[model samples]
Target: MSDEPLVRTVRPGVRVGVDVGSARVGVAASDPTATFAHPVRTLARDEQHGTDLTELVTLVEELAAVEVVVGLPLLLSGQEGEAARIARDYAVALAARVGTVTVRLVDERLTTVDAHRRLRDSGVPGRGQRKVVDQAAAVLILQTALDTEARSGKPPGEPVTTGGRRKKERRR
Candidate 1:
């Protein structure tokens, strides 16, 4: 049995969040210090799943992300379904492909609604907003994971935090 750590050491670097949908893949990445999540871009689905995954892996690597948190689409009843299963499979595949980074699956409930609300409140045109809703949802998912890790006294992935500068806790 291998004794490798579940969560990689929290380096002073960027982390990423992803909102994966059937048609679109959204990306959000944090600053190197893991202090802020910035909406990256939404990639439209390619004809092949492998191509899409490759593109996503390239994007994450391009950002120099240390960790990745993928939003798991759970049903309103908090149960896993086909969508959740697919997400889990994708996450595992991504983790393997990335090799050096940590990946996490975070419950994604009401994230779409929240994203829509945010866009509307920000006065984004409906048509233009559609292109980025997934990205916004990804930001929400990443922010929530970061907050949960902070509040639970846990580092992302392994549920433990090393001694370091703690930031003000916030919820999404």
Candidate 2:
């Protein structure tokens, strides 16, 4: 198989957004036209790696998602810090988990903050937000990516390559 990351065409179709966290993963999906993203559900992270990935793969299959967008949490100054590294690792694992499906890592600096604010404004108590915060963040991540692609005529962010290579490396 080619080691290069898959570059999916920027078109209208169902897309899934993922916000990976230590304990929970938030999932969101876009409409067939890719106009809006809505929260799907929050999934618990299994302690075993295989089980976690399996759940994600099952979700992908069930959604028939054309592309999977994984949020990359970069620093405010655009640097890839430790959190970014973890996100990248998750993206690579996720890409490998769901073979043939495109996984893109979009910059998601303030999506979590936005999610929290939205939940607060909507009267979701801080105590109860944990159950759905990840889903809310996933929605923001996907919506931002969809909007970016629509405005630029290009897919937002970089695709996550399978195997162990980084996205910046070119296959020789």
For model 2, the run of ten residues with the poorest summed lDDT: 163-172
Off by over 4 Å in 1: 1-11, 47-49, 156-172
lDDT of 2 at 84: 92
Predicted structure 2, TM vs. truth = 0.87
Candidate 2 stretches with Cα past 4 Å from truth are 1-10, 164-172
lDDT of each residue in 6-68, candidate 2, tens digit only:
554458678999998888889999998888999998888874755766788898899887788
> Which lDDT values do the candidates have, in the order given?
0.76, 0.86
Looking at model 2, residue 99 earns an lDDT score of 66
Q: If scored against the real structure, what TM-score would every candidate get? A: 0.80, 0.87
For candidate 1, write residues 19-78 as lDDT tens digits. 888888888998876767889988886646577778888987898776788888899998
